[model samples]
Target: MRQNAERCTAALSAAVSNYVDIFEHVEGQIIHAHQKDQERKRNCVMMPSKKLQTFLSLPKKQMKKSLSETSELEKELGNYTCALHARLSPNEHTAIKNSDYVKLSESIGTSVKQAKKIATTVKLIRNVQKQVKKPEINPSKEFTMAALF
Candidate 1:
C-alpha cells in the first residue's frame, strides 16, 4: 500500500506540475506576443484576452479562492482512483486534512446503523431485481373441495 501510494503520489504530482507549467508557459507567450504586437502596431492592436489579463491580475482573494477550488477538485478526483493505495497529491492531502468529514457525516445522518441498514436494503433490492422465480416441485392442478363449496 505504501509503495502504491508513493507511486500514485509521484504520478499525480508530476502530472499536475506539468499541466500548471504548460499553462504558465502559454500564458507567458501570450503576454509576450501582446507586448510585441503593441510595440509593432503602435496603438492599432487588440488587447490581451480577458483570460490572460485575469491570470496576470489575480487579486489576493481570487488567488486564495482559486487555490481552494483546485484543492477541492483534486480531492474529488481522488475518487476516480481504482488502483493501489490512495496516493494523495499535496493539495489533496491538505484538502482532506482540512475537511471535517465526521461533522459532515453526522450532519447527513450517516451513522454505522444507517449504513448497515442501507447495505441490507440495497442487497434486498438487488435480489428483487434478479426476478428469478423458483420452480414449484408439486403442481396443484385439481381444484380443492373448499373451492368447490
Candidate 2:
C-alpha cells in the first residue's frame, strides 16, 4: 500500500508538471491570436474563429466576476494563477499579500496588467457601495420652497 501511495504521488506530480507545460503553450497561442486579431481589421464578433474562441474560453477562475459582468471589456485578460495555492482555510477568503502572487505581465504581457488593474478597481467600487448606505428622503417636502427664490 505504501508503494502504491508513493507511485500515485509521483504520477500526480508528473501530471501537474505536464499540465503547466500545456498551459504555457496555450498562453503563447493566446498571445499570438490576440496580436493577429488586432492586426486584422475584421472583428471576431462578425466572424468567430476557433483560435479566438479558444483563447477567450480559457478559464479565468481567479476573477470575482466574468468579463461580460465588468464594465471594461478588456479587463478579463490576466495571468490566471491556480486558486488552489492561494486559497487558505475556510475562514480566510482574501488571498495573502505576498510576492509569490504572479503578475500577469511576467507570464503574459502589459495588456494583461492594465486589465487586471481595471478589474480590481471595479471590484473595489462594488465593495464600497455594498458597505455604504444611502440617506432616505421624503418625496413630498424634502426641498425648501424659499430656496427657489
Candidate 3:
C-alpha cells in the first residue's frame, strides 16, 4: 500500500512539473512574438516611402505657386483700380461698370466673370475704407516730475 501511494505521489509531481514547463515555454514564445511585433512596427514607421514624400512635396509646391500668382493678381488689381479712379468724374459713382470690367478682363487676361468678382471686391474695400475713421491723437505733455529723476 505504501509503494502504491508513493507511485501516485511521484506521478502527480511529474504531471505538475510538466505543466509548469509547458507554461514557461508558452510565456517565452509570447515574449518573442511581442518583440517581433514591436520591431516590425518600428521599421514601418521609420521607413520613408517615395510616394509619400512626393505627395507631401507636391501640395507645398502648388501652394507656393498659387500664393505668388495671387500676389501678382493683387498688384494688377491695384493698378487697375488706380487707373479707373483717375478716369472718374468728380460727381461720378464709384461703382464698377460693365465696360470697366471688360477692359479689366482684357488687361488682366482673365474672364469677364473673374473681373466682375474682382471689381466687387474693390468696391467692398472702398466702402469699408470710407466707413472707418482715423483716430485723433493728442500731443504728449512733458511731466515736471521727470526732471527730479
Write out the backbone clash pairs for model 2.
Answer: none
Who wins the TM-score comparison? 3
Query: Between prediction 1 and prediction 3, which has the larger lDDT?
Result: 3
- For candidate 3, the clash count comes to 0
- Candidate whose lDDT is highest: 3
Q: Sorted on lDDT, highest at the top, how do the candidates line up? A: 3, 1, 2
Q: CA lDDT of 55 in candidate 3? A: 26
Q: Estimate the lDDT of model 3.
A: 0.52
lDDT by residue (tens digit), candidate 2, 1-149: 99999889988999999999999999999999777645442321121234323434444432323444553432322212112222222211122122222343232233555535533433443343333224345565556544565
TM-scores, all candidates, are 0.26, 0.26, 0.29
Q: Give the TM-score of candidate 2.
A: 0.26
Candidate 2: clashing residue pairs, number:
0
Q: What's the lDDT for all of these models?
A: 0.44, 0.41, 0.52
- For candidate 3, lDDT tens digit of each residue in 87-122? 333322222544377766664456889767656655
In angstroms, the error of model 1 at 30 is 0.5
